[model samples]
Target: MGASRLLVSGIACLIDFDDAALSGPPASAVPTVRSGVDLLIEDGRIVEVGAGLPAGTAEVIDASDRVVLPGFVDTHRHLWLTALRALTTETDLGGYLESVAGRLGPRFTPDDLRASAYFGALECLDAGVTTVQDYAHAMRSPDHADAAVSALEASGIRAVFGYGFPVFSTARDLVDIRRVRERYFPADDGSLLTMALSPMGPSYSPIESVREDWKLARELALPIAVHVGAGPVAQRPIATLEREGLLTAGTVYVHANSLPDEELRLIASSGGSVAIAPAVEAQMGHGAPMIGRLRAAGIGYGLGVDVVTATAGDMFTLMRAALVTGYLGAGSRPSPADVLRAATLGGAEVLGLAGRIGSLRAGKRADLVLLRADAPNLLPLHHDPVGTVVSSAHPGNVDTVIVDGRVVKRDGALVAGSLPAAREALLAAAHRIAG
Candidate 1:
């Protein structure tokens, strides 16, 4: 009667994102088909996958009308900015900075950050996003960063906590990096909550500061992500970083909207990955990112929602926007399946967690979402399964979600976290900060 209260069984269709795992171009597995597979989860790792299991194994769920998929992994976002929604609706990049830097940046109380981070987290979970890379740049105070992580942990969402500059500034402050490392990177589970030092880069921080941050990241073996692309007015962060020897295997550069062609190859050579938030880039006037060229250059590329300000958290929407817009930019050459690859497995590659999560294989983590193929807007299913997921699916169609072998959502419901309180708290925080 209350929240299924049991283990789940039965699976109708399992569309593995492993469509091109072995053929070369950073592929997923294979055989995306109507699978009558049964999943067994115990102590977190996926214990079994294949035909039916023995009777009375646990609880049984009727999954005949559902299509299962791996939970979406979002590579980048400022989840804590959930409270400060659209403060720059009528402004540009400078305006976004002025508003955030001057007002909301200094006003992010612990409670405010907690509320905002939780609010954003709820949206992602509701839309079937299992993992999010949270760039909490406004963490001026230690409590602020702690609050953000606390909110994420409380939300029961998996995350990579990007320990960034305080108040979104580029300047480096003399803070306790070890404290941050110890707090998030617990020895028990090294993968869940990670500590990544993010600098403001050339524009915000001095070249020395950026380089120092890179060195520290390298020493700690933590991946470094920075804002690149956006435009050509200033030396693009990617080129500047490459020239400075900061672009290394540890670098995970974000954006590159207006980067030159050769720069993509440079990125690949440097062993860095590219994160393309196509929708946010277009809306924010950064022009189109060269996704096709980046892919061809053997650089791992993934999609980002950026923030709730300019894009939705649903990876499907981000993937759809990228598919159509990138095709339009390239005059519709790449197949929609290629776009889906970027969203799922490609993203997994960028995050460096491809083998364990990402796709639905026997040994992979059972992170998946169940979408309703029979929705009125969805109509007849004639197109490619991945294409339909990319172009047509929405959060509403995500009827169920499984993360880390646990049912996080079932029958259009959430099994972790709450939004009403988050919304209320963030709303109050915004008004208080603005006032």
Candidate 2:
């Protein structure tokens, strides 16, 4: 008798979006080959990757003509906007505050928070996203933070539940950052769910208030993510933070879209990472030289699905929109894999969690996406798989999603049942806000 074999389903295309050890971007930025390959996932990590394995000892997922990629990591998203989608798309930043984050944010009861957060998470999961840097910036009340945390917990998604200062205008309206740190941060076990200080930053927050929040994070050694260049664009916060010697690696400067080359070089030199929300930037009149300058500084850079009010929360849209906008605007174009990695590994680096998540390596956590290329729209794989993903694909192509060895989505459906009610909760909130 032959040795017992494990299931080895073959994929027509496999793109490993890691390992670019070269002077510039490698030709195969994401390694690929159009050959029969089967990924044996054991205890969650991919155990083997080759062809012709014996069978019968493991379950099989026949992905003969499908594509596989790492699950997306959304570095910047206002998950609270799940309840207020497109509510203020027509409005400017002030209008956004008054309409959604101000009015709708205040109206969210804890129940409403859970409903929207959990629902938004499910939306991401069903679309094959396994990780999130959720900017949960709409804590109407302190208890709403609990609702936000609970929503991430229940969804089985690996996320940094950004513990934002209570949604407010003046820094005085902000809650005690100290209390938020001590009470709501999920700092146990260094596990999937953790917290980052997401103070509204110097624009919405006073320098004094922003400094206070930074103090709490520094005291706790917690990473902090701050929104920049999305609003008044008055001062380059990166330069300001650098001058104060606060632009350390743990400081993630998001949407530095309007900042120029000089400012970007300063951020890169200061060891701070940047997350460009290109779609939201263009949609909001944030400005040109958005992602291009950030990349040129030899600084760490990533992508994000920022501010769902003016954009969709899914990463696919972010990738496609950014890549096209970037290539069309640049002298040279980044390969699709460079684009993909920006959304995953690049994003993981932005959040300062690169080693634990992001890739499909042996020691990394099992965070991945399975696209059913066997589907009609996915058939006829002509171009590169990574290109197909960022170009031709949508959320519907996602057949399964895994996060930290757990299957969160399968067969184009969310594993959690509460998602429906949660979706309804958002619909109801929109109506109430409208009235």
Candidate 3:
């Protein structure tokens, strides 16, 4: 846990909205940007945010010439593939599956899983992503699952660890899932770690297996994260779920690149959300990014770094991809404000964590990022902070990052763990697995 700290005298872009406004579309919620404001955090929660707040006993951190905002939330990411960065840059969807899932994924040891997950979480923290939905689908054993969870806890990032079934496994039973659930994530105890069920949906699994997985998720009351519209399954996945009466709230559909408008409407009607990885979809030929389609259907969607194997693993790159592809596909560019909202609050909403970690308001977790306004790429932050962030900013400009009232990255470097050790471990594991 981190000590109480006061961030003062900065330009803060609070992507805040009243809890009553939760029923409205996420795009309709406006942000409140203010200058020379102060935020007081105590006991891992924001206590007050306004002008001339009393610092009292808290350590005052000078946020002078910085742009303070809520930390980025990555809605969907395969953390286990971090060591395989750039391996799929020139591959299509089938190529990716054949190379990674079919070849390398089966060779990972528990130690390798720990190294990849820990380094991946650290990379995210260094890039100012405080919260991430780790769609872990590479579990080979219960030991592998334990290693991944332990690595996330040791890295100090707020994560929803989606307990996924193995990619190539044929067993459809819940024995392993039940064991992991009971051992690691029995309930939502307000810790930094939570759990979700990442199953191969109808597109990849049979109807009977999908039904059993959904039933197990409901029995445990955990959220569901599944892939839809990516593979070449003939039957419509959403329609199949609806026919089986398995569509429910708190489900995060990943890579809905090929899903039609009717399925988008069904997701919105069912109170579900989406996690879009624009760069990956374009590179891997999953299809076009669904920003415009999600907006047209009035569904809330969050941007993600699907896999570092195909694209850069940062929110800034994903934001830029989302902006350009949105314009190219829809013929209308989305505003920078809307895109930034999707990176912060919209991502939180997708992960079912808006109430605790999305916006920088009173009574929310103190997960914040401070960007250096003096960086060459972001110089003269002239009257448009959100635009600068969405258009020009990168990971190098992230000066400080705080998660749960704890400062993880300070002075442009990660401070929570030994990154050099993590890097060496990752390299060793990568070489071993590649061989």
* TM, every model: 0.90, 0.89, 0.96
> Pairs clashing in candidate 2?
none
Off by over 4 Å in 3: 9-20, 27-29
Off by over 4 Å in 1: 1-10, 19-31, 86-90, 166-171, 188-191, 230-236, 330-332
Q: Over the stretch 1-435, how does candidate 1's per-residue lDDT look in tens digits?
A: 022222334665666656345323453223365556766655445566667764354556666666677778888889987766655555665666677766567887888888888888888888988778888787777787778889887877767778887644545553555577766774525345556666666544557777788778767677877777534323666677768877677466788766676777777887778878887777777666456666667777778888676566788888877876777564224466666666667777777777667776656665667787677756655456666666788899989877776677778988777657776887898788875
The superposed Cα distance between candidate 3 and the true structure at residue 394, in angstroms, equals 0.5
lDDT of 3 by residue, 354-392 (tens): 899878888899999988878899877866777788899
Best-to-worst TM-score order: 3, 1, 2
Return the top candidate by TM-score: 3
